[model samples]
Every structure is written in C-alpha cells, then in structure tokens.
Target chain A: MDVFFQQLVNGLTVGSLYALIALGYTMVYGILKIINFAHGDILMIGTFIGLVLVMNFHLAFVPALLLAMFITALMGILVERLAYRPVRAADKLIALLSALGVSIFLVNFAQLVWGTETHPFPVNISGEPIILGEVHIGTLQIWALGVSLLLMVGLHFFVNHTKMGVAMRATSFNVDYARLMGINVDNIISITFAIGSALAAAAGILIGVYYDAVYPVMGYSAGLKAFTAAVLGGIGSIPGAMLGGLLLGVLENEGAAYLSSGYKDAIAFALLIIILLIKPTGLMGRREQQKV
Target chain B: MLELKNVMVNYGVIPALKSISFKVEEGEIVTLIGANGAGKSTILKAICGLIKLKGGAITYQGDTISGMGAHLIIRRGISQVPEGRGIFANLTVEENLGLGAYVRKDKAEINRNLKVVYDRFPRLFERRKQVGGTLSGGEQQMLAIGRALMAAPKLLLLDEPSMGLAPLVVKEIFKIIKEINQTGTTILLVEQNARMALSVANRGYVMETGQIISHGTARELRDNEDVKKAYLGH
Candidate 1:
C-alpha cells in the first residue's frame, strides 16, 4: 500500500510536468488546428535559459522562472511568424511538413550551440521530504503540483472571463466572423503562442529540477510523451490535456512497477492506440461536424 | 457613402465577380438580389475585405479601401453579419456579442451597446447564457445581427439574413432590418428573397452570373418584367 502511494505521488509529480507541456500542444492545436511539432524543443530552450539565469546570474527561482517564460514566449511568437504563418493558407499537409522541418531544425540548432553533452541542473528546488505514517512526499512534488494547479486555474479564467479570452474563443470558433468583428486575428494567434510557450517553459524548468539533468535531445522524447498526453486527453481541449497527462503518468508508472520497466513507454503508446480505436476523438473531444 | 468601381474578383482560375460597379448612399438600404452563384454574396465579401479584388477600387467616404485587411475594414466602420449567421457555436450568446465590440476602447459605450442589442433582440437576451450552436435558426440569425450591431458600425452589411427561416421569422427579421435602418445605420443587404428585399430596400441591383445586369430604384426594379418573371415569382 505504501509502495502504491509512493508510485502515485511520483506519477502525480511527473503528470504535472507533462500537463504543462501538453497544454502548449493543445492550445496551439485549438487555435490553428495544427499540432506544433516544435513545442518540445521550445521546452528544451527554456530549460537552458532557466539554467543560465539561476546558475550563471544567481537569480532566485521565481524570478528565473518568469524570465525564462518571458524569453520563451518571445521565441514562441517568432516561431509562429517565421515558420507557421507562411503556410497558414496552404494545405494541411504542407503545414505538417513545415512543422516537422522546424522540429528538426531546432534540434540541430540546439546541438550546434550547446553541444551534445548533458548538463546537471544546478538549483535544487527539492528540499526535505514530508514523512507521513508510511508515505514520503518530496517538497518539490507539492510545489510542482501547487504551481501547476495555479497556472491551470489562471488559464481557465483567462479563456473564460477576460475580453481577450472571449475573443480567442470566438476566433477559434470562426476566424472570418471574428475578423468581421474587427478582431486582429494575427495578433490573437501570436498571443496564443506566447501563452502556450510560457507554460511549456515553466514545465521545462520544473522538470529539470526534478530530473537533475538537461540536454539538447531531451526535447525529442519528452515532446513525444507530452504529445501523447495531449492526444490521450483530447487534442483541442484544455482540461482534457491536463486529465490525460495525469492519467498517462499514473498508468505508465504503475505499469512499469508491476510489469517490465522496459515496456513502460510501450504500455502508454499501446493504450493510446486502443483508445483511438475505440474512441477516435479521444475521451473528451467534441466530434466536429462542418457547418455550411 | 460606399462605392465599388469596376471591381473584379476571381477564385483561382474561375471568375467569381467581374467588373462589378455600384454605389450606396448614406441613410439608404441598398440590396443586391439574385439566384445562387450569381456573385451577390461576393459583393458583400469584397466590401468587408474578405476576398482580394483583381482590379478596380472600393472607395468608402472617398478613400480607396480595396486592398485593406478585413479587420481594418471593420475598424473603418463596416461590419458584415456573414451568410449562414456565423455565430460562435461553442460560446454563449453574451460572449459572442462581447466580441463584436472587440476593437472599441470605450467600456461604457460597449456596455450601452450590449444593452441596446439585448433590448432589440429580447429573445437573445433570454437565451444569452445558452451556447450559440444550440440556438434555433432564427435565434442564431438574431444573435448574429445583434453581434454586428455591438460594433456600432456606420454601415451594416447583412448577407442572406432571411435564409432557412420560417416565413414569419423572415418577416420579423426584415422588420428588424427596417428598424435598424431607421435608427440611422446605413444597410447593404444581400438576399435571394427578391419580393421581401425589394419591399425594404430604397434601391436594388440584379446580379446574374458574375455581373450586375440591372440596377435602379426599388420600385423600378420591382416593376421590371424580367426581374418579376425571374425573381419575384410573378
């Protein structure tokens, strides 16, 4: 029972990280209906930036995190303008190919700049673990879970209550109609990228602290997992991404503990396939029917 | 107040609008009526900057706005309630209306506009909390018009406002259009319902294929034998 609880805690911690990254994918998908294949590399870039701010500049954790987020948000806007906007009116296949090209380019660019070696994440946000009767929980786990929840709540409010949020939702519903309402859709898309990238940056820094390492190629695998989480939850649904991330994390951890550790990833991918076969729209996705 | 001079538009290799020309005076409801594929809708799309023109110029208040962006055109006081009443299906009616005032900076004015819209479409007010997609066809059309009014446009463009509604609902919508025009908002309406459109508009244009074949005062267009036989079901 204690072991189960420990795995659960571990799963939740990992799930929070995945949720953050998955949000970027889901949000970009929501607005553009295109999976941002380069999202994970943005996370990697953010981690390096966070490392520089914390270790080289000796900044505090909160300030470093915010600065990383701001910088990554800018990068996100740049990627949208340079890479995505050109193919905005093209066929879906063209956009997909362009996104893959961007992912490859980012990975190569990172390797060229930072080299292929892995670096130890310097700041230790994790302190002593809280001991219960039989379960032990790390301080970082609580912090991670708390911060993730706060961000999600903030996002929910922004998308629901605020004017710009309403505009975003409207644009997502019908771009041409939104434009007729005098909405600068280009500006809105940039803002969406900014917000999603900032969240991914936050996730990157948190995961760096938890794992104690960062590397150029880390984005590839981590991005794949987060993409899975987004798909598992429902690609265009925000809450679905969070739910899927948590569920995927728990299932993968439990599967690893009980079954062969080598098949942990295999289990998650297999589950995704099964879910797709049964419910092609994912668990929470609304089935889309084109309106004339 | 608005003029399209020899405007030309093409959809890829096929011409959708060919050298179309027309003028809309302030305080008059001008309508273009035609069968499906007559390029009647394209004229509204062009005025709102939704599609690029191949040639000619669209001048509003003497400034050429032919190549401006759609959002910029909206900011310049032209708002289109597109065909099929393009309401945001997932959003509530209130939120959809809120987005109509997206460009305006005055909070008090926006609130007042919201109230005015609610007053005009009381049915919309009652279903303000409901998702737009779930609204009845007539209700959605009302919401679409109310949303455009939230922009407080100087010139309103409505495309097929009476499509796919009950006869009574269509009459009510036309009445609201007249009421909106009387309140000093200039209107440019597009419709396939020639009998209803000619009854409301001050002037009318008859489009066929990709060009305007005839245009005159609403009375003259209504009395023309060709128009009556082709459109008015006379």
Candidate 2:
C-alpha cells in the first residue's frame, strides 16, 4: 500500500510536467491543426534560458521562471512568424516538414551553444523532501504540481470566460467564419503560440528543478512523451491533453515500479497503440464525420 | 454604399471572377442571381477581401478597401453569413451571436444587439445555450443570420441562406431577410433560387460564368423572357 501510494505521488508529479508540455502541443494543434514537432526543442530552449537566468544572472526562482517564460513565449511567436506562418497555407506534409526543419535546427543550435554537456540545475528552492506517513515526496514535486494546477486552472478560465478565449474557440471551429465575424486569425494564432510556449517554459523550468539537470538533447525524449500524452488525451482537446498526461504519467510510473525499468518506454508506447487501435481519435477527441 | 469596379480574381490561373463590376447602393437589397459555379459567391468573397482582387477597386463609402484583410472588411461593417450557414459547431448559439460582435468594444451596445437578435428570432433565444451543431437545419440558418446581425453591419452579405432547407423553412428565412432589410440594413444577397430572390430584391444582377450578363430593376429582370426561361422555369 505504501509502495503504491509512493508510486502514485511520483506518477502525478511527472504527469503534471507532461500535462504542461502537452498543452503547447494541443493548443498549437487546436488552432493550426499541426503537430508542431519543434515544440519539444522550445522546451529545451526554455530550460536553457532558465539556466542562464539562475546560474549566470543569479536571479531568484520566481524571477528566473518568469523571464524564461517571457523569452520562450517570444521565441514561439518568432518561430511562428518565420517558420510556421510561411507554410501555413501549404499542404499538411509541407508544414510538417517545415516544423521538422525547425526541430533539427533548434537541437543543433542548442548543442553548439551548450557544448553537449548535461549541466546541474541550480536549486534556488530548498532541496528538502516532505515525508507524509510512510511515503516520501519532494518539495519540487509539490511546487511543480501546485504551479501546474494553477496554470491549468488559469488556462481553463482564459479559454472559457475571456473574449480572446472565445475567439480562439471560434477560430478553431471554422477559421473563415471566424474571419467573417471580424476575428484577426493571425493575431489569435500568435496568442496561442505565446500561451502554449509559456506553459512549456514553465514545464521546462519545473522539470529542471525536479530532475536537477538540464541538457540540449533532453527535449527529444520529453517532447516525445508529451506528444504521446496529447495524442492519448485527444490532440486538439485541452482537457484531453491534461487527462492524457496524467494517465500516461501514472501508468508509466507504475510500470517502472512493478516491471523492468528498461521496458518502461515500451509499455507507454504499447498503451498508446492499444488506445489508438480502440479509439483512433484519442480519449476525448471528436470523431470527424465526412461532410459531403 | 459599395462599389466594385472591374474586379478580377483567379485561383492559380483559373479565373473565378473576370472583370466583374457592380455597385450596391445604400438601403437596397441587391440580389446576385446565378447558377452554381457562376461566381456569385466569388463576388462576395472579393468584396469581403477573402480572396485577393486581381485588378479592381472595391470602395465602401468612398474608401478603397480592395486589398484590405477580411477582418478589416468586417470591422468596416460588412458581415457575411457565408454559404452553408457557417455556424461554429462547437459553440453554443448564444456564443455564436456574441462572436458576430467580435470587432465591437461597447459592452452595453453588444448586450443591446444580443437582445435585438434574441427578440428577432425567439427560436434562437430558446436554443441559446444549445450547441450550434445540434440545431436543425432551419434553426442553424436562423442562428447564422442572427450571428451576422450581432455585428450591426451596415451591409449584410447573405450567401444562399435558403440552400438545402425545406420550402417552409426557406419561406421563413426569406421573410426574415426582408424584415432585416426593412430595419434599415442594406443587403447583398446571392442565391440560386432566382424566383424567391427577385421577388424580394429592389435591383438584381444576372451573373453567368464569371461576369454580370445583365443588370436591371427586379421587376424588369423578372418579366424578361430570357430570365423567365433560364431561371424562373417558365
């Protein structure tokens, strides 16, 4: 029972990070209907930005997190303007290829700048593990889960209650209709990228703190996991992404604890295949009807 | 008032609109009647800047708006209820109406417009919280028109509001169109149902292929022999 509880806590902590990163994927997909393959690299870039702020500038945790989020948000917008926007009206394959190009460029660029070394993430927050009964939980895990929950709640309000949120929903429904309703789609797309990237930045920083390490290639695996989470929950559904992330985290952690650690990734991938085979549109995805 | 002087459009070298010229005078229901693929919809797309005009100027109240973006055109008070009643399927009927006033900033005026829309179509008011996709076909049309009206547009462009609807529903929609026009908004209506369109329009343009082949008062076109045989099924 204690082992189960411990694994559950660990799973939730990891799940929270995956959910945050998956939001960027789901949001960009929601608005543009593209996978945004470079999203993981954006997370890596954000981690580096956080590292620079904390390690070099010696900024506090909250300030470093904010600056990293701000910079990465701008980077997302810049990526949209320069890379994604040009191929927006093109075929899906072409846009996807463009995204791949960006991912490659970002990875190589980060490798060149950071020298391919895994650097220790400076712990501005206290490195103390909180013990509850027989289960042990890290403070960073609590912070990560708490912060992510706050962001998710805030995102829910922004997407449901606010004017821009409604516009985003409208745009995703029918872009041309949205335009007819006087919506500036470009501006909305920019905002989606900004918000998605900001969430990713927060996730990146949280992951750095939790793991106590940051590296150029770290985005590849983390991004792949988050992408899977988005697909599991439903690619264009925000709540779906959150659910998928949490579920993926719990399942993977349990698998690792009970089964061989080497098969952890395989177990997750197998679950994805099973879910997709049973429900191709993901858990909460709306099944598309063929409109004549 | 809106004027299109020698507008042209092409979809990658295949001409959609070829030097089409027309004017929509203020407070008049101007119907553009044509068969499918005759470019009536293209003319509306050109007017609203959804498609780039190859060579022409679209002026609204003496301002050149030919190359402006679609959102800017909507901001200039020209809202289009696009073909097939392009309601946001995921959104509620009330939310769709709110989106129609997307460019406007006045909260009180928006509420007033919402009330006006609700009053005009009580059915929509009843289904206000219902998802737009769940509505019946006729109800969807009403929601679409109501959504467009939320913009308080000076000129409303309705493209085939009667398409795919039952005859009874079509009549209701046409009645609503006339009522909306009577409330002082100018209209540019595109329809394949020439009989119904001419009956309501003040003036009409007959479009064939990609150009306006004839233009006259609605009565003149309705009585014309060629129009009677080709469009009226006489």
Candidate 3:
C-alpha cells in the first residue's frame, strides 16, 4: 500500500467530519455575522447524548444519532434564545460575548454531568477493509464520507430549492427587507441555529464512531480545527466550509504522516493562517463588489 | 385606505418624521414629494412597520396598525417597494418574486400573481433566471415593484422608484404605477422628482424639514411657486 494514499484516505475521513462542524459555524455566521462559539460545545453535548442513547438505552446507532441530532438542534435553539437573541440588536460584540458564555456554560455543564472521563464509543459494526492497488480503506471511512456527503447534499437542496431556505438566504441578505417581505426574521434565525446544531451533532457522533471514544473535551480541539476549516473556506460560504474541512483534513493527515503526529493540530491552524494570508476571504468567500 | 395621524419618528435624538399626518384614500395615487432628508422615506418605513413611531397612530382601513410587526403588516395587504430597490442580489429574479408572495400560502394564487407581474414587466420574464443584482438599475426597480406586486397588496408603498434610473425608464415605471392604480391598488408614492410625481398623482403633499408644507391636487402643487422652486426645479 502507498503510504501517501493511505494517509490521504485517513485524512479525508476526518476532514469530512470537520466539514460537518464547519458548516454550523459558516451558517450561523452567514445569518448573524457572528461566530457561534457555543457550536463546539453543542458537538460535545451531542456526543454525550449519543453515548447515553446507545450505551445506556441500548438503541441502534442510526436511531441514537438521529435522536441526538434532534435534541442538539433544540439545544442550539435554546442557546440562541437564551444567550444570543436578547443581545441581537444591542451590539455585535455583545452577541459574541454571549456565545462565549454559552460555550463555557455548556462545557462546564458537560463536565458536571458526564464528567471528564472518556467513554469508549459503542458502534460495534465490523467490516473488512477495502483494498485497492495501493491503499486500505475501512468501513468507518466510507460511513463518515458517505453520511456527511448525503447530509451536505440534502442541506444544499433544502437551502437552494425550498421556500424556507430561500427565506433564510433573503434574511441573511438584508434583515429589514426580509421583514418587509413578511418574513419573520427571528424564526429564520432560530431555524438557522437548529439546522447548524443538527449538522454539528451528526459530526460529533461520527467523530466518536470513527475514534471509538467519546469524551467531553473532544469538542474544544475538534471545534477549533473545524473553525479553522470554516475560516479557511471563507466564513459565511457553505461550500467553502465543506471544501475547507476536507482540505484541512487531508493536509493534517499528510503532515502527520510526513512530519510528525504531534504536529497534526498545528498543521490545521498553520494551513488556516497560510490560506487566510493569501485569500483573506477563505476559499469561497465572495469579494465585495462595489457597483457604480 | 391608509392614514398616518400625527406620526413622529426619530433616528436617536434627531427627529426624522415630526408628527406628520397624511391620508391615502382607496384607489388613489397620493404622492409625497420632498427633497432628500425631508422624511419622505421615513414615513414609508413607519407605514410598513419597519420603524416604531415615536408618537401618533397609523390606521389602515380604519384599524390602527402603528404597533404591528412589519412582517404581520404585509399579511394585511400592505407591501412596500423600499428605497434602494432592496433586491436580494444573490437570489434569482423568480426567487425574489417568490419571496414577495411569502406571507400567502396559496400556491395557485402566487403563480397567477407571478404571471401578472411577468406580463407587466416582460424584461423580468426574459431575465427571470438571472440573479437580481446583475440586472440594470431600472430592471432592479421593476423587480422591486414586481416583488411588491406579488404580495397582491391593496395598498402599495413605493419609495423613490426613479432613483438612479434613466429618464426613459422612469417614464416606463410611472406608466406601470398608473396602470397598477387604475386596477384599484391604492398607492402611497414618495418621490424626490416632484415634477414626475405630481404629474402622475391625483393628490400630492409637499414636505420639507419633516413636515407637510403644502397639500393640494396635482395641478395645485404644479401651479404653486414655492413647490416649483423647491422641488419641481423649474
């Protein structure tokens, strides 16, 4: 097996997961023009919810994942309602601060309830690795890549084709005009949070399934990496987030295989800095057009 | 159909609209003509529920709509073609029109209204698939008016539709506005171009320094020396 190809596959599997979380960041940022700092903690909460559903209740993986995603979506809405909504009209900085508060509250709350100990993830499916001429691919890799792609495609169709999705885009374009068009902007915002959180939840559970370990602090590091991916793709663009995540994942894995495993996290941020330095708007971010 | 009774609005400490009162009886084109900073746009915003009135009441068909949410106000058959055209630059022309009918759930009715809008502006029909931003200024203004029309509003509020448009295009837009009024949709038009506005309007109000300085028929405003000097630019 080619070492480079093998590492690339490994990187893509992880990157797809990152893309999922990055989507949440990009989406909320698109609507509110603020980074949802609490999105990371939402990932942690989703993992724990998944863990309890599968481990304690003995439910199947798919059901648990869906349930966790639904619950995490509600948690997302709750965070927006409690922390972000009241401060929405005050100052942009206040909303950012409230997001940080929500992030901290979720992390400590998770520690208080689920504790700091890591729980081994309960996905017990097994399959032989798919071998090509030079690379070995596992079922988890396929699952991670396939599920994320499916969700992303579904999201794309929903945002582009559906009425509510069009309303979301309209609201993001101009809040006042959206209100003039009879769009309830507050509901649109809540729906944005809900969708973003659900995607993050799915990513969180996938990370746990891939690593076979679920822990409270996983979100902190993973979220930072995903956030880097979001910025890499240009913050508010959806496809940019996905592309950024995949690219970051591949780069991180290649760097780990060639340079050192200890440099994996550093590689992600390093790539982010390099990308931002070159393109400032991330990969897919639109350059502001000044019409004469 | 719509009336603003002593409506006052402020942008922080600076008063934008000063206890201004105006009326638009059903099926009439009532133009509010003023220079920039004369609160012409502010009155439109207040009527559409985009801004809270600092004081006074706005009644639509005899019900006080002053404190209603902007989103809810549209559902009651009031829609606005705001200043700047307010097109969703990223959305296609068809999508922009679809959003105009958002408050209504009846799909068949929406498509019928879509046909009416398209027929009224064949230029929009030709470019329906293109994103709204790429359209010429006049086309965007048409899309803005077309979008408001899709709401099937009883009272339509137009804010500076002629801003940034060619003279020929302005003539065409005002023609459509006249036709829309003939079809029984009441119009409250705010315009900086006083000559064109008063020419098309049945009744006209001249505003200055956040107050209506003169009010009369189009011919009355046309004959008034002060109106011609300040706004008609003769």
**Using DockQ as the measure, which candidate wins?**
3
Docking class of 1: medium
TM-scores vs. true structure, each candidate: 0.97, 0.97, 0.97
Candidate 2 residue pairs in backbone clash = none
Error of 1 at A180 (Å): 0.9
RMSD versus native structure for model 1: 1.5
Say which docking band candidate 2 falls in: medium
| Model 2 TM-score (2 dp) | 0.97
User: What TM-score describes the B chain of model 1?
Assistant: 0.99
In candidate 3, what are the lDDT values of residues A1-292, reduced to their tens digit? Answer: 3989999999999999999999999989888999998898899999899989998999888899899999999999999999999898788999989988988888889889988898889687666779998797998888888889999999999999999999999988888999999999899999999999999999999999888888878888889999999999989888999999999999999999999999998888888788878988988987656232
Worst lDDT window (10 residues) for model 1 chain A? A283-292
* lDDT of every model, 2 decimals: 0.89, 0.91, 0.91
Residue B62 error for model 1, in Å?
1.6
For each candidate, give the interface RMSD after superposing the true interface residues on Cα. 1.7, 1.9, 1.5
Model 3 complex DockQ against the native: 0.73
| DockQ for each model | 0.72, 0.68, 0.73
lDDT of 2: 0.91
Choose 2 or 3, whichever is better by DockQ.
3
